[model samples]
Target: MSHGVNNVRSRWTLPDYKPTQKYENAYRVTARFLLWVEKTKNRKVVDKLDAALRDGTYQPEMWVKLTGLTVDQLWKEYGDDPALALTYK
Candidate 1:
């Protein structure tokens, strides 16, 4: 077999038991939101949001409105806590 085809299996292999993909999507979404916040507004909001995130009380909808994204989009993009997401509606 050619090396390219043979190595495909190796490339597809994930860590033996580690959930490396866990939170990756959330990180990506949060990173995007943070960058947007930093670019469009002062650091104060970012700092406040960061604090709220830690508190697990920040409704992602606020960011959704600021970013013009939909609740479903945020849901899929961030996988935010369902209870918090409910407040968005």
Candidate 2:
């Protein structure tokens, strides 16, 4: 039984997989936004974000309302933080 061979699931699980820069940037941005949300917002707002995501209703305006920051401001504040290094495969 070649369980090891069958166990392979997806390209992302491959050892040599490298995410594109766009994907990595998006991940970093989302992570930064979520961190901000956790730090500044209440649990109810987090719940709303979760629900909106689940329901396919999440929108940029929700972020603006919660963080009181526009997309440009978010990018300026968190997007270019060199500490948030991109992961390499």
Candidate 3:
């Protein structure tokens, strides 16, 4: 995946590097999810998951247990991009 860009010396070399359209779309979707998290506030469910992840105690079942929501539902609330529908599972 490095594709020789990891140690490139100059910013001009950046333009020579490009991901495929598939990767570009994936990046955009991930960015959208990140932006949603950044913009959202006072989300108690996400906060709990974040804390669990940071503390190394996160469990897949917690998605339903704590939030009373499926992973897909949480993702929908976060961004709900169609491209991300298959992302949760």
Top of the candidates by lDDT:
2
**What tens-digit string does per-residue lDDT give for candidate 3 at 1-89?**
22233334532222211222221345444444433443443246657877999999999888678656655565566543322221111
What are the clashing pairs of model 2?
none
For candidate 1, lDDT tens digit of each residue in 1-89?
12123335455311221223332446444444444344444346667667789999888675554555644554344334222111110
Worst 10 residues of 2 by lDDT: 14-23
What's the C-alpha lDDT at position 84 in model 2?
Answer: 28
| Alpha-carbon TM-score of each model against the true structure | 0.31, 0.42, 0.37
Instruction: Name the 10 consecutive residues with the lowest summed lDDT in model 1.
Output: 80-89
CA lDDT of each prediction against the hidden true structure: 0.44, 0.49, 0.47
Native-to-model Cα distance after best TM-score fit, residue 54 in candidate 2, in Å:
0.9
Q: Could you tally the backbone clashes for each prediction?
A: 0, 0, 0
